[model samples]
Target: MFLCGSYVPPQYLPWSPGSYLFLLETCLFLLFACTAAGSAGSMPSMNNQLNELRSLAAKAENRRTETGIPRVAMVQGKIPEHMLAAVYDPMINVILQGSKSMTVGDRTLRYDPATYFVMSIDLPAVGSVHPSVSGEPYLAVSLTLDPTVLSTLFADLPKPVGRVEHNLGFSVAPVTTDLMDAWVRMLRLMGDPDAIAALAPVYEREIIFRVLQGPHGWMLREIAAPDTAMARVNMAIQWIRRDFAEPIGVERLAERASMSVSAFHRHFKAVTNLSPLQYQKRVRLLQARTLMVANAKSVMAAAFEVGYESATQFSRDYARVFGLPPAQDAGRILGDTRAIRP
Candidate 1:
């Protein structure tokens, strides 16, 4: 038989010291869990806000316009999750919903709900967006950065207090709550046709300001500064992006960058992680891939189009970079596409 006593208060239970410690620890853990849960819960709202922004842009613009001002576009519907091989001219891309991964050389970067990806210089790369949940699909807003405006803004701002350096044009960084809020506001402006005319530039400027103040600010600063080593390398990169078919002499590239031969070599490699010749080869190879897959250019023609003088040399380099000779890589690309299509 058990003798029942009066209810024991939590503070006066048997093994009270141990019980008290356990309760205290349990409460602490619960508190931490709740805090974490709250933070996690906020993410869905952020994604929603981004989605709303994209929706506004989509509703505002009817036809895709090609102009001197790089366009801001919103895409809808089902898009095949495939790699796009092209040069990313100066642009800021914000993902309002879904997510994407971009491959440049060996590195793969993800841009999703909480982040924005920027390409401050021209670069050839491959990019793909992941599929969405519940068929809601992905949403993205792209605003091309105006280099003239960027250069102007840099001159107006006070000189930063440190030496500038060049860096890869592409970067991924977390967008601030303030920046996200600004994006929402800008998107709202799109609904007001009158306001969009007056406000889009203002919003775009604000976005750029947020970028200049963000983690990769120094990279932007260096790119905008005309006399910096990074600026020199950027000029070389631009030349290569635009004229890959031209045989580039090291001295000639150095002259274009306004740097001495050795200085240009050091700075170009430091910024791009590749020498000028290597950079040209990379761009040319990517172009060759595009020509083969999209335009149905033969291996020899594609090679010549990208400035490869010798067919054997072209095949060797193409194989080295793409893991197959031109003919084989072209066949594989076509085969892979056919396999994926319904």
Candidate 2:
């Protein structure tokens, strides 16, 4: 199962004394550089924030709890090469080390510490991580974006002067010092429970504000506004997600979005990078996989549960998405000892 962040295995430990000393030196250098950059009203480079991010992520690794501060998470691990699929929520990730690649539609994006990843809507994608060989694992901090918070903040900001075209809901942008600083403060709160209750929201707001001020800020604005085209597509997406087990027609989905069939098809594909039917098929297969793993349902049962009338067709579609037939995939995920039927 995918943790909200990368899983931290027990073998990873907190930074050593030597590493702490190095981090101290790095912080000192960053302070001087940031001061110089601030005098010119320019943001400091992201290189200034990597060490602190790394140290903070290291400390919080493997220590995440359900009752911990909500909407905040840390991840650290040397993940193996594996294709995993999930519907990504609206969140921001600041990578401190290593790199990860995500495939949305036909596009593939690879990002590292110098960049921040944002998903402004729920999207399904395939992802894999590449870790360094010298024992420096992938590390990152994730903060879930709250639409209520975005709406409140968007109102106070000045309006955009020009029309912004709709793009895919996911983006990677250069990290700025202000955003990094806010993230650092948020991560630090994990160590002090008393301070978290009072301070986490303030810091989280700052992070959201900084993102709103960035290049893809308009996308967040669209997500927050209920009347926008993107928002309408999102409504249709929610409908599909809720009733994925039932057959849905494009005309009905378009009506839900208050758009013509052709327009709805275009916008849906633009936002999600998948056609309406493709999206539903993906949703069904993912749900079927969950049933196999979480409920230990047999391949035929799982297929029928997800609206598939033909077991052979279900197997073909499941294999196309997950790289394994239904039975073998179910056996692997559920750790079943019986021989998997083809």
Candidate 3:
């Protein structure tokens, strides 16, 4: 179990405890279901606000940035396709110009400009980004979730009323005008470094507040309450992620979450879309890919390093997830100058 204040990353997302870094090319949380785009008229001329935000976000690159704002980052231009397939960290992502897609199990969810999503759990997501019609590069901004901060917001707000079943790990909705306006204010601070410390938190609270009024607001509410089913599942995800290379069993993980075996399995699969063993396999596969691509480890070595006993089985799994044999995939990535960068 994690300490009270520690950040629990999504299942299958590998974290470097020392650096508190997510070793992911791009980050996202798994949304349980992809609903149709929200009502178009909810926000009049959303593109007006979206365009302003897009201009501000274009300053970022494919890599994530700290940008002097706490728990916020931006990515623009090309993202390495290989990295998108891995599970992701929890975040609120708003696309500026291009489109993004995340495949969780058999379902694929795509979001265009003027849309945003809140993600909170295991992903095993096959994600990709696409350029907009006018040829703009993929551009987006994200707010890394902080449970402590989220919890602070609950005191003043009325208790949210919703069925437990409705509070999934994540969900997508159209970017409300109020939400976009808050984001615009948040990003505008990039040009005014001296003002970030005082204003960033204010703007962040506004963003969270706006989302809390939306249809999926209960999702965020549940994740921060500490004792909710979603939070328990989050705890279980952290347990698996911390010891992915070591073998784990659903029974043990269930006990850790303080839920019965069947309940834990139901909640875990509801949020992550993968069973306990399958989630572990995803973590192993993603780590092996990184070792092979970034560290130049051999296929067999990478397999064993990530707890795979059989090289052939590792190769087969790698091919299925990445759509190519391990060696070939590694070689292809290494050939690209940008892919080799740490």
Tens digits of lDDT, candidate 1, 218-251:
8778888878888778888877777889988999
Which pairs of residues collide in model 1? none
> 1 or 2, which is superior by TM-score?
2
RMSD of 1: 8.9
Q: Rate the local accuracy (lDDT) of all candidates.
A: 0.72, 0.78, 0.80
Give lDDT tens digits, candidate 2, residues 211-330: 989987888888887778788888898898889899999999999899999999998898889998998898888778777776777788888999999999999999988888888877
Error of 2 at 68 (Å): 2.0
lDDT of 3 by residue, 162-275 (tens): 546544576789888889999999999999999999999999989988888887678887787778888898898888888998989889999989999999999888877778
User: Which one wins by lDDT: 2 or 3?
Assistant: 3
TM-score of 1: 0.74
- Residue 335, candidate 1: Cα error in Å is 5.0
Query: Model 1: residues >4 Å from true position, as ranges?
Result: 1-48, 57-70, 76-83, 132-136, 331-342
Superposing every Cα of model 2 onto the true structure, what RMSD results?
Answer: 14.6
Ranked candidates, highest lDDT first: 3, 2, 1
Q: List the residue pairs that clash in candidate 2.
A: none
